[model samples]
Target: MKYTARRTWPEKSKSWEYLGESESLEEFALAFATDKALEVDTEFVVIEKAGAESEIEFFKVTRTSPYGLVTAAPRVESEGSSTDNATTKDEQSSNDGGDDNYGGVEAIAGAWRGVISNILMFVKAGGAAFLFFLAAIFLAKWLFNAW
Candidate 1:
């Protein structure tokens, strides 16, 4: 997939900056992990095979994170083919920028919700038990007074 836009990194965070649009959540993750922020140039000397002209191809290494080599330009998107599907796909993928950090957020939110729900339930149960105790004490006092 090709990334064609720019995103800012969190201020002083461990996350890498995402640039451009990605095809999918997986694609975004791959790009972010492998993107190199600088250009690389290599020089080599070689003899032509039989009398063939020597050909040189340029490659740009964007980033190299845990995933692998994330490349650009060489896989450039085709031209003159913009449509709703393409635009919508871009929107969907870009909207999923949250996918990378889903685990942490989801775990924290799940834990928080569970804790809050349990606390509420405990409080309700405790309140009911206290009310019952008070009622029993009042009943005992009333019976003793009657006696």
Candidate 2:
């Protein structure tokens, strides 16, 4: 299944039609917001080609805990096509620099997540350390005075 991607606004129904299924307006809006927040523009069109299965599958993986959505186009091999050609194309495309923008954005997002995680970890650790130090100091002072 070869699909030509085009940019269009969401209809008044407040839904995005993906693979003939209607997603709720709120979900679509959240998806868009998450994409924008992650520095992804709405200009890219992902063409879902026919692959291993008979039908084209479009998947949007939205992380519930952390706000992020990863949209992937299913890879489909044409009937009677050689596996060698498919493998070669995939390898070539992976090495191609043309799609670097998407990868770059993803990398930036990943970096942001890593930074946030590290900060949170440090904050927790520091808080614990500080509390322990304070407790030890107070206990030593009390023991000294009592003695």
Candidate 3:
């Protein structure tokens, strides 16, 4: 079976960065594990094909907490036209500039979400502190009364 290694960063776009093709799965796995070119948060998939006209199999490669790479089981996809399904260098380049507006909007939204999350975290901490202060005051008052 022929294995093809491809990577894509979800935060960037859906375009796949084709690494290379190999006949050995071990070679692809080794490269996926040790390749410095691959980004840390990006995803890698190995496409397996039995023959030229067979169904394509996709295996996702993920990094474990121990910094080791692991490949998931193959997920079979239906065969389609080569030109329609394939992500060539030319196609990737052409699609890059077209999505600038979409990416900008996504970035703005992400930033706003992050800000809101930080605000909520601070509010939560402040609320907890206020409750703790009230509890301490009540405890002090009870101790004074008993004395």
Candidate 4:
């Protein structure tokens, strides 16, 4: 997952700055944990093809965010098609911009969502198979009790 984060002032979009993109959100979290800023918002995105026959490919992410914003864009195929180019965030930032050192992803905040999202995706992808697995476990439990 990719994270595009900008630090925000406490008063809601009162003043903001784009810190740039990280291949992982941990980079952003490090900043989040340490930064005195009371608020920050993040976006998540996924890229996929419409179908095997369809020439069109699309990137989508739910707009739903308990924080601020969420987004998705096609994986970087070419600079032309890549919506999340590394330099784009720098270009957009109002602050004098460059990569900041927050000592890797270990120092990040809001990681619980990342973990939850991973589990959610697993369950979503395994919808049918997961149900079957649960049913098998229930059957085994019943048989053991009967015996």
Which one wins on lDDT? 3
Off by over 4 Å in 4: 1-3, 6-10, 37-147
Higher-scoring candidate on TM-score, 1 or 2: 1
Q: Estimate each model's TM-score.
A: 0.32, 0.30, 0.32, 0.19
Instruction: Report model 4's TM-score to 2 decimal places.
Output: 0.19
In angstroms, the error of model 4 at 141 is 99
Residue 70 displacement (Å), model 3: 51
Could you give candidate 3's per-residue lDDT for residues 1-147 as a string of tens digits? 555555543333354444555657656655654664444455556555556664333333355343455545433335664455446533664576534355566668888999999999999999999999988888888977633
The TM-score obtained by model 2 is 0.30
Give, for candidate 4, the lowest lDDT window spanning 10 residues: 54-63
Q: Name the 10 consecutive residues with the lowest summed lDDT in model 2.
A: 6-15
Kindly give the stretch of ten consecutive residues in candidate 3 with the minimal lDDT sum.
Answer: 8-17
Q: Which stretches of candidate 3 lie over 4 Å from their true place?
A: 1-102
Full-model lDDT for every candidate: 0.45, 0.48, 0.57, 0.41
Candidate 1 regions with alpha-carbon error over 4 angstroms? 1-102
RMSD to truth, every model: 16.8, 17.0, 17.9, 21.3
- Model 3, residue 66: C-alpha shift (Å): 55
